[model samples]
Target: MIPIHENLKGKVAVITGGSGVLCSQMAIELARQGANIAILNRDAKKGRDVIERIQTSGGTGISVKADVLDKSSMEKAREEILETFGQVDFLINGAGGNHPDAVTNTETYQDEATGKSFFHLDENGFSKVFATNFTGSFISSQVFGKDLLQAKAPSILNISSMSAYVPMTKVPAYSAAKSSINNFTMWMAVHFAETGLRVNAIAPGFFLTTQNRNLLVNDDGSYTVRSNKIINGTPMKRFGKPEDLLGTMLWLLDASYSGFVTGITVPVDGGFMAYSGV
Candidate 1:
C-alpha cells in the first residue's frame, strides 16, 4: 500500500450516497487515507456495511441514514456528524441516479403524435431524475458545507457525469442534472470564496455502475452494443475502475495540493469528451 498523506490524515469527510457501488469505493479509499468518514445513505444496512470495512482496517467512520433530497434529513445528519466528529472538513456530493422513463431507445429523432417524442418523455421520471441528481447535491452541500466554511482546508467535491460535457442520447434528465452540477460547482466556489472554501466536481466517465449494469452488460456478463460503442470511443480502450478516481478525489480534497484549484469539473474520463467518433 502507498503511504497516506499527512494533511488528509484524520480529516472528516462526508460522502452522500456512500453505500452505492462507485461511491463506496471512494469512501473506503478516503478512510484508508486516514480520514474520519461520515457516510449519508438511505440504506442503513449498506451504510453500516461500508463503515465496518473501514473500521476493520482501523479507520474511523460513522454511517448516517439520511436522504440528501430532504433538507431536514441532511441537517439532522450534519448534527450527528458534529456530535461525533466536532467538524466536517470535506464534502462529497455523491448521491445521484437516472431513470428509465427519462431515457429513449435511440439517440435520433422521435415521434410526437403518439406522445412518444422527446417532448413526451415521462414528466414524473424526468423530474425524479432531476431531483435526485441536482436537487440532492444542492441540499447536501447546504448541510455538509456549513462546517466546511469554518474547517481547516475546507473543500467540497460534487460528482458529475460524462453526459454533462455533451449530449449522450436517451438520458435527458441525467445530462441536465449533471450539467447543473458542473455549473453549480462554479457557482458554489465563488459563493464560498470569502470563507476560504474550495468547491470542485468530479465528472466521471463510463463505468459498470449498479445503475447502468443492465444497459452495459447482460446477466451472463456479455457486453451490449452500447458498451462496445463506448469502449471503441474511449481512447484508453477500457472502462474506468472505481480506483481510477481516488487520485483525483484526493487531489481535490487535499488542500496542500489543490488549494487554489476550485470551480473546475475535473473529468476522470478516458477521452470520452474529446473523441468525436471520427
Candidate 2:
C-alpha cells in the first residue's frame, strides 16, 4: 500500500501527462492521500480513465483536456480545475517524450551509416522534442504560479531523468531536454524561494514504460542490448518500478517532510547514479 501523507490531505494537485505510466501512478497515490487530483492530457478520454481509477479508490479527481505546449489550453485547464477544486496546491510537470526522428539509430556518428544518424536527425523533430519536455514545463509552471503561491505551502515537482546527469546514447535530444529540466528546476526554486513555493524534481532511472519499451525490450519480451547495458551499469541490476518513485515524491510534496528542500533533483535510480563499472 502507498503510504499516506496527512499533510497532503485536502490539497489540490494538477498533474500534466497524468495518463502516462509514471504520472498515472503519481495521480493515484496523490488521490489516495486525499488530494483532489486534476489530470491534464491532450486525450481527455485517457485522462478520464485515470480519474476513474482514482474515483474507484474513493479519491476525488477530474480529467481535463489540455495541451502542455499550448498556454491557452493550459489556462482553460486551470480554470476547470479551479472551478472544481477551488485552488491548486501542487503542480507536477510530467508531460515529456522523445520523437523517433530525433533519436539516432546508432550511438555514435558513422561515416557510412544508412540509418538515421546524428547528422541526419530532423531539425523539426529535435525542436519538437525539446519543446515538449522543457518548454512545456515552463509554460505549465507559469500558468499555475499564481495559484500555487496563494496556497499555504505550495510545491512544484518536475519529472527529470538519469540522462540529465549523464547523456544517454542514441537520444541526444531527450538527454539535452532533461538536462535543461535540471537547470530549470534550480532556477525556479531560487526564483520562488521567498514565496514559500518550493520546487524540486525526481530523476527516475531506466524504467520500462510504453514510451521506452521498444528501446529496452525486444518483440519476444527479451531485454534489448541497451537494456542489458543499463542493468549492467546499475548496481541493483534491474530497472525501476513505478512504485519506486512514490516515497521521494511524497517526501517532496508534503511540506512537513521536505519544507526546506528545494532546487534539487532526487534520483530514485536504485544506485544507478552511485555505481561505476570497475
lDDT of 2 by residue, 1-278 (tens): 86678999999999999999999999999999999999999999999999999999899999999999999999999999999989999999999998898999988888998899888899999999999999999999999999999999999999999999999999898999999999999999999999999999999999989889989999999999999999999998889999899989999999998999999999999899898788
With a 3 Å backbone cut-off (N, CA, C), the pairs that clash in candidate 2 are none
Backbone clashes, candidate 1: 0
Candidate 1 local lDDT, 1-278, one digit each (tens): 54587899889999999988888998999899999999899987899999999999899999998998889988988999999999899989999998888887766665533334586589999999999999999988887776887898899999999889886887889999999999999999999887889999999999899899998997899999899999999999999999889899988988889989999999888998888888
Q: What are the models' TM-scores? A: 0.95, 0.99
Whole-model lDDT per candidate: 0.89, 0.95
**140: Cα error in model 1, Å:** 0.9
Angstrom error of the Cα, residue 129, model 1: value is 0.5
**Candidate 1 Cα errors over 4 Å, as ranges:** 112-120
